[model samples]
Target: MTPIRRYATAPGVPAAVGPYVQATSAGGFVFTTGQIPAAPGQEIGTFADEVRATLTHLAAVLAEAGSGLDRIVKLNAFLGSPEQLDVYNQVYETFFTDHRPARTTVCVGLWGVALEIDCIAVTGPGGDA
Candidate 1:
């Protein structure tokens, strides 16, 4: 087994939440933490806004892990309400049209977010250089 490596964004994301690593890599797999629609302290405003912000942060974590959204093979999405599903899919499609990763979405009683998203990506063939 290859040694796992961890990365945090430059200046890193704040720790107002959990202590989990932003992304963890092992054996070419990069698993990201569930990203909420948090604007640091502000509420996760709307469905579209939440989706956009969550994906943006997820993308950055992927980059730090030597991967990108294009490499994502699986995604798990959590929603605070079922009504947001359609709009959520629309916003998700905007970022993931080409690299259509397998996904699972669920409506849950998420505390501080309208949505949360996480992914697992395989590092590209060059294998993290």
Candidate 2:
């Protein structure tokens, strides 16, 4: 029998800008959709601000799915401009701290947003369940 997929939502996190859920969990892992910087009814801002907002939303999504930033195993980050890479990294480090999840970052065209981030995390304590 196939395991059921569980969708996650958090009031503090911004709603999906497109037709997608915030995150989903299955088989002991939670996968988050790429989070854009713009929140509901909020104005998008600078590159650093976008990075912070995006990660903050990611954190909330993970938490809602019984995971957390520290439990994240991988991250796919997209930047609107390669020039903003340094700023993104600095702000990202502030949130991730010692939890060094494997990551990939690339420059891409984003609609009205400077950055987007998505992650995969294990469920339960220290992602060990």
Candidate 3:
């Protein structure tokens, strides 16, 4: 038998702009979609603000999925420009703190947003390590 896949919907987080859920879970892992800076019917903000908002959205999704930032095992980040890497890191540290999940970041064009982030985390009680 295969494990059932579950989708997550977080009311506090912005709804998905595309045809995808906020997060999905299966086999003890929760996978989240890349969250952009703009919320529903909102304007994008500064680079730092965008990064902060993206992470905040991710946190909300994780919480809704029975996971937290501390349970994140990996993260993939995209930035509008390489120059914003420093600012991104500064704001990212504030949320992640000492919990350093494996991460990969890249410079890429993001429609009208400055930053986007997606992550994978353990599903239950800090995960089954």
Give the number of the best model, judged by lDDT.
3
Name the regions of candidate 1 deviating beyond 4 angstroms: 10-16, 39-41, 126-129
Tens digits of lDDT, candidate 3, 14-112: 777778888888888889998876664477667788888888888888888888888999999998898999999999999978788999999997776
Rank ordering of all candidates by lDDT, starting from the highest: 3, 2, 1
Top TM-score model: 3
Candidate 2 per-residue lDDT over residues 19-98, each given as its tens digit: 77888888888989988777644676677887888888888888888888999999999887889988988998899887
Clashes of 1: 0
lDDT of each: 0.80, 0.82, 0.83
Determine the C-alpha RMSD for candidate 2 after optimal superposition of all C-alphas. Answer: 2.3
| Ordering by TM-score | 3, 2, 1
Clashing pairs in 1: none
| TM-score to native of every candidate shown | 0.87, 0.88, 0.89
Model 1 lDDT tens row, 1-129: 699988755233433365667788999899988887664557656668878888888887888788988899899999989889999999999998877889999999977668878899998575322
- Local distance difference test, candidate 1: 0.80
Name the lDDT of candidate 3. Answer: 0.83
Q: Is candidate 1 or candidate 2 better by lDDT?
A: 2
Between candidates 1 and 3, name the one with more favorable lDDT: 3
